[model samples]
Target: MVFSNNDEGLINKKLPKELLLRIFSFLDIVTLCRCAQISKAWNILALDGSNWQRIDLFNFQTDVEGRVVENISKRCGGFLRKLSLRGCIGVGDSSLKTFAQNCRNIEHLNLNGCTKITDSTCYSLSRFCSKLKHLDLTSCVSITNSSLKGISEGCRHLEYLNLSWCDQITKDGVEALVRGCRGLRALLLRGCTQLEDEALKHIQNYCHELVSLNLQSCSRVTDDGVVQLCRGCPRLQALCLSGCGSLTDASLTALALNCPRLQILEAARCSHLTDAGFTLLARNCHDLEKMDLEECILITDRTLTQLSIHCPKLQALVSQLLVVDLPLRDERCPATLPHYRRNLLSGRVSSIILGFRGLLVGLTWEVENLRVTVFVFGCEPNTGTQVLTQIHGQPVE
Candidate 1:
């Protein structure tokens, strides 16, 4: 490209090499690609490894082929820190082999929805990319225990992993993972149906640093599995047992007795859970914030009242088809009601989804030092079945 007397490509000629690279770092991937086409000098500056440190190819997932990933890996090389190739169906093990070899310093990699890749891709990652920390392999159906073995062999610094919907994963794979990667803090095994109680045992024994675990839909896990898990992982804060039909109240009892720092608990669809389990939990775990008791048929208003009285830090409570009861009388209401109502009025309790068969009928009363405003949702105005919907000091319609 010829520059006129007024232009003279003065900017590129006058600027230092460091300043030119610094300027190119501000451009996005599309703009960088466009800039690379201007001239030889601009092409070298635009394709510099430092400028391509973090690349997210999710926008071009459908159009991106394996060659694009390989070329990017080569260009970025040791300078690349993060790369996301999510939903790129065309990316296979062969391209990933080159990527892992070239970009060995890559820290965070997302291969989610890349269906064409198999265990060979994991093998490449394990051979290189030793500094890998976070990985999202969600919906990678082709992955099996062999892939877990590869990840366990390497990726020791891995802290967060999402293996959601990977159907082939079993107890053996989980054991191998936790045995090697004991530093794992969060593991999402949602929808991995093949996992049984043995896998939980392995996680309890090996992964002691685990704080967050999602066992959603792992139907084979019984109360015994949860007991072992809670006994071992005392640092557990967030636990999801949604759709695990085999779990009973014993699991909740185990959690309450062991995990004192328990904050978020999701036991939706666990039919055997009663108010007895939750009453004990609320008394023991005062830091509880979010509770999802949807589809728990056995629990009544007793559970709701107990949680409101004891768990002062409670924010979101999702109890669909359950009655909400908050006694207003001076003798009946506990001293903690004032503190709970204060937290509610101060906007700490942002969401309280209590579903009952009724319409909102306003009611306000003074119980001890607290002036509480309750929105009672009852089937009929005359009926005595009053369900407390909110406690925001002002009437909620």
Candidate 2:
């Protein structure tokens, strides 16, 4: 393994440029920058555009300036396919305009948390980057419908878009987006409170290929909108209705009747849902894997029993409750007692939660193939809240 001076100098001189680039490819941005300062030949190998195809500057987001991005874009040019500038708050439209012009072949771009960017960036991207597939503009609050319009006019190949926390978005913007990006498979619209029934209607009309739709906190949408959406977008597999207070059992019934392939249903804080709605959902959506029923006060033991009986694929059920009665319980056990209380105290369970609030406690355990997690909340305790979790009968921390 010992290298003599002749052997050491000969290896670098004899190695092919392709092999040197291959070795440089394994180095990260900081190391490559250091390598560029070693010597002239190392500088050429380090700065070669082919070795900088996919760069993630998230670790140095605070230090990454506009000039750094511009230089990287110029260096990589058409060879760059993915670039993530997530949390780079200093990045603005001018730098991204240069980036779009240079990196025309880029497919996946993560601009999440880039608060300084605006519609101009989207305009630049649409004008150049037609191969764009996944774009995350999460929390880019400054851009409004103009950005959506720009994206709709171009970027027809977009598949996954996350506009979470973009409060300026309205129905018109959503309509324009769905009309153009008809192939959208996953769209996250969380906290876009301006969106109403019309936005969902637009999604139902054009985005039939949608598999995951997160409409969390879009409280303006009603059951009628959800019904129409469910009927139109039957390919939906994961849906989030959390904080959509206007939704009722009618929405659940619509999902059960039309979206049978539903796998993940996050209905947390949807207070109107009752056992009757969940019973119907369980019977039809047999492939259901995870369900979040937290804060759903109306659902009782009947809903749990129905799910345990019908939805065999159910893996996780999150609810806030003091009691549950599943059909799998022995008939000899008292009906007044919860189905898992005996096993929970006997240490036969795989997992356990000892505390949540003094008034109500949540115990989660895995039995055979079923994994249930119940989370309950009550008034703040005088002694403060403490959570102790145990896995395989051993306390964790």
Winning candidate number (lDDT):
2
- Which candidate gets the maximum TM-score versus the true structure? 2
Candidates' TM-scores?
0.81, 0.83
Candidate 2 local lDDT, 1-397, one digit each (tens): 7655556565568898889899999999889999999777789999999989999999999998899899999999999999999999989999999999999999999999999999999999999999999999999999799899889879999999999999999999999999999999999999999999989999999999999999999999899899989988999999999999978899999999999999999998999999889999999999888888888888776786787667767666677554553222334333432444454433222222222223334456554434444343331323433333333433211
Report, for every candidate in turn, its global Cα lDDT versus the true structure.
Answer: 0.82, 0.82
Decoy 2 TM-score against native: 0.83
Candidate 2 residues lying further than 4 Å off, grouped into runs, are 1-8, 326-397
Stretches of candidate 1 exceeding 4 Å from the true structure? 1-9, 326-397
Give the least accurate 10-residue stretch of model 1, judged by summed lDDT. 347-356
- Provide the lDDT at 22 for model 2: 96
Looking at model 1, residue 168 earns an lDDT score of 98
Quote the positional error of residue 133 for candidate 2 in Å.
0.4
TM-score of 1: 0.81
